[model samples]
Target: MIEPSPVKKEPIGKLISCVYRTQLKRMSRSLGEYGIGGGGQYSFLKAILMTPGTTQDQLTVKLKFDKATTARSVKQLEAAGYIKRSADPEDRRSHRLYPTPKAVEFQPVLQALLDESNARLTRDLTPEEEDQLIVLLQKLNLED
Candidate 1:
């Protein structure tokens, strides 16, 4: 009978952080290759695509970003011809986000990149294993 080898453990939080940073760097490089520099801009564009007419406050909540950061991202995307903001019908003070045609046109490419990244990251995992890992990660992130 063979005894199990000692389980080597490191701080899970630090490991997760490093993984995130590395992935972010890769994403930033890819976006730069496509002439988009800001991660916030990519996220904001995704939010607009997912929820058209979303207000700045809604985007702030959905993106887990502060108001100023959300505003800046929206502004930059608008300047880049990727998005537009219109005055909210219900609240004149609020602005609703909308993806421009150019932004909508990029959706397929964006999705392809995401799928490729996922495939690369889970190269050795089966679909069920990937699903289980997602569930486990969510469980670890549970908050009251």
Candidate 2:
């Protein structure tokens, strides 16, 4: 009978957290070069572009961010002229988010950066290998 390897496996959560933090640091440095601070701002902008007029509460749920963090990111983006917020006509108390012309202009640049980053990260991997890795990561989500 073949014996299983005795090497102790690191907890998946810690591995993921470490990778996420490392990626975030790299992304933050890149974003800082473009005069944007690190956080959920870019993701929020992309979300707004996809669903124009999305509410703050909706962003909170979609991004899995707390209300305060979402609000601060939105406010910063708005102040930076990247987004616009207007009161919802149907619900006076609610506000809707929209990407400004500036934000729209930045979309292609941001996407190119993301594409380049992905390409760089998977430079040595074959397409099939990359796909397999993505599938395996998706399987991890199934456990949750």
Best by lDDT: 2
**Model 2: colliding residue pairs:** none
List the candidate 2 regions with Cα displacement exceeding 4 Å: 1-7, 142-144
Candidate 1 lDDT, tens digit per residue, 34-118?
Answer: 6555654677788889989988899888778888988888887888788888998888998888988988998888778767766
lDDT at residue 55 of model 1 (Cα atoms): 89
Per-candidate TM-scores read 0.84, 0.85
Candidate 2 lDDT over 1-144, as tens digits, reads 225569997888898787667666766677765655667577788899889999999999988888998999899889888889999999999999999999889889878876876787778888888897678787775321
User: Which candidate number has the best TM-score?
Assistant: 2
Q: How many Å off is the CA of 111 in candidate 2?
A: 0.4
**Candidate 2, position 9, lDDT:** 78
